[model samples]
Target: MAFVTIRDVAQKAGVSITAVSQILHGKGRFSNETKELVRRTVDELGYVPDSRAQGIRLAESKTVGLLVPDIRNPFFADLVSSMEKMLYEKGYSTLIGTSAEDVERQDAFITTLLGQRIDGAIVVPEGAESPGIRSIIDRDLPLVFVDRTVEGLDTVPSVVSDPYPGIESAVETLSQLGHRRVGFVSHSSLESVSVNEREVAFRAIAGRVLGEDGVAVVDCDNTFRSRKDALMELLSEGVSAILFAYSPDAIAIIGLLHDRNMDPGTDISVVSFDDIDAFRLMTPRVAIISQQTADMGRQGVEMLLSRIGAKRRRRAEHRRIPTVFVQRGSVGVAPPERRM
Candidate 1:
């Protein structure tokens, strides 16, 4: 089949090429019915417009590139949805790319979006060594980092959670529940800002609150399986309560406990940094330190747009979104048997 063009759409809709062009480009004095007919004919004929051609014609593609670690993660899904909604309302569209937590893949995504001449980009970087994400900043391509940020790219605009409020609340709440030695489940050091912040805060806050040597930290990969041995190690040391750094760690720990004939919340207490619906719906609802995922998305896009042309006269803009703590049944008085 031949490539359908605007001419074909105009002929099928019984309108002049000029009228079709006008309506297609959102111009001209055309009735709603006429516009609808042209749109339907364009769709029926599968007349796909060349975005590069369109970009040249409009001077701006009116499109933004968005990159995430993984779309399967519920938090990322929610973030992309909210960001897309907000951008759509502003008459802009998003071109989404996934890195799947691989640095090379992330670089490839950045290169592809850049090649497409994306007006700007928003990224939730996978780690500190995200050259792909950093390239956007180096080239001054209107970029905003959400959730976690790459190191040395602090000059770029960013929106990240402090993680102190909710973490402090968790330590305080656990201490009140008579937990002396609370374990922290997190990724290894130098992985990403998110993990590093959580680890630093946990050591400083939880250690200070629980007293010297009161905190036991398990620095492992993001996977539960990768951290399972660390979990058992912490368990063997008689940690009365454990704080999961993310949703995956929490879910994995819960499963591990059940498998070993240990009861979550009863045999040991649990707290998570990332809030998820599954945590709430679990048999023993898990307390969570919650980040404003949707708000982060909205704020990130707003910042990117504001800095699209470096219009804002400043060194760099940074927004630190605070987190909240949600209480649930999963955290209880530390079991006497487990208390050190």
Candidate 2:
């Protein structure tokens, strides 16, 4: 199929290409009839404006690039949906890319977004080192980091979850429930500023509640076998309750418990990050620490918009959405035999 250009729309609508261009962009004085004619012809011919070409001429794309790591993660999925909706409401289109937790893939997406001359970018960076991200910064492209941030990118505005509130509440709740020894399970394979922060927060909070000797931590990959091994490791240490820094690991452990016909509440109490639907739907609902996905998305976009087209970039602003802990059936009384 041949591509329909502005010239085609102009010819069909009985107008000059300049008229069609101005009419499409809502610029220049044109008769109402002419505007209607061009629009009708465009719809008839399925002529889509070349935003890239227009962006080059106008120095604005009215488009923003968003990059995330693994959209399959429910948290990221919700963030993406919220951001896209807000962007659309603001009369901008979203260009979304996913890295699937690969640094090289993340770089490739950044390169692609740059090639398209995106007006700005909101990134959940893959890591600290990336020529692509560095280039965007050096070029002074409007950028905001969300969910996670990279080292040396402090000058870039960011919105991330503050894990202290939720972690503290969770550990204190467990302590009140007579859980003397508790465990934390973290993803050993993935590294990020936010992930590390959650672990750090959990250690400090859990240590205070359960004491140094009473707190145990297991770091494992996302595999089921790894998660199972991590769970067994904590159980062997006589931990009556556990917290997961990563939600997928928590979900996996719950599945493993189901297969063995073990009660999550009775055999082992469970709490994890992210308020994904699956957690709520489990046979025994799982308690969660929610990072407030909608708020993160809205605030990240607001930061990016503030930086875009500013005469002088202001000192980068930072925002944190406090995590909230939700109590559910997954938490129960500490097993008498497992109590320290």
Candidate 3:
């Protein structure tokens, strides 16, 4: 089939090619009637803009690249969808890359995206030492970090969820419900600023609500066996209630509880971060510290767009979306026997 061109649309609509181009790009002023006519003609002719040709002419691909650590994580999936929708509305397409929580893979994806000549990038970097992040910094390409920021990368803007609000609420609620001691299961194996922030926030809040001696902490790797061991450790610490900073560990713990014929709420109260579907759909709905993924996505896109449209690179800024605690069946009254 012959590819329909803008020239064909211009001829059919009785307008100059520039008129069609301006209308399609939402650029130069055009009468409503003229714009409608051009759009109708373009639709009838099935004329799709040649992004490559346009990029060569305008020096912009009109595309944005997004990198996430794990797309399988419902939070990232929702974030990607939200960002893609907003970018599309702004006349830009999104190229998505998943790193699978690997530093080398993260750099590789960044390199590949750079090759695409994306106008800007929003990355959830694995860490600050990534050469890929440095390349973007050296080239001065518009870049925004989402979910977490790199250590000492003061020049790059970031949007992350504020854990204090949700952590404070979760600890207070548990304390009020007779949870004298609470354990925090942290994903310490991963070098993530946000994860560390969550851990610190929990310790502070738990200490304030239940006393410093009430706080129990354990590090867990991203593995079923490790999470199981962490849960056992927290139980041995005599924690009546427990919070998992990572959602995967919470899911694994729920299964492990079932294997031991223990109930999540009755035998031990449970709470975790991220309001993903898996948590909501569990037998006893798991309590969540929702990071507001939609808000994070919107903020990231807005920040990246501002950088991309600016005449000169502006001073980097950081934005935080406050997380909220969601009460669920998983957070039942702390067992009297388990209470300190």
TM-score, cand. 2: 0.83
Error of 1 at 87 (Å): 1.0
Relative to the true structure, candidate 2 has a C-alpha RMSD (angstroms) of 10.7
Candidate 2 Cα lDDT to native: 0.86
* lDDT by residue (tens digit), candidate 3, 1-340: 2245678888899999888889999999989999999999976765556645542324567989999999998888999999999999999999999999898899878767765667899998896568778777776789999998899998999999999999999998998899998999999777899988999999888888889899999999987778888988987899888898888888888898899888888888899999899988897999999999989999999999998888886999999999999989989898888777
All candidates: CA RMSD (Å): 11.1, 10.7, 12.5
Name the regions of candidate 1 deviating beyond 4 angstroms.
1-58, 222-225, 309-314
In angstroms, give how far residue 104 of model 3 lies from its true place.
0.9
TM-scores for every predicted model: 0.80, 0.83, 0.83
Order of quality (lDDT): 3, 2, 1
Cα lDDT tens digits, model 2, 88-142, are 9988898899999888899888867765667899999986768778768765789
Alpha-carbon local distance difference test for all models: 0.80, 0.86, 0.87
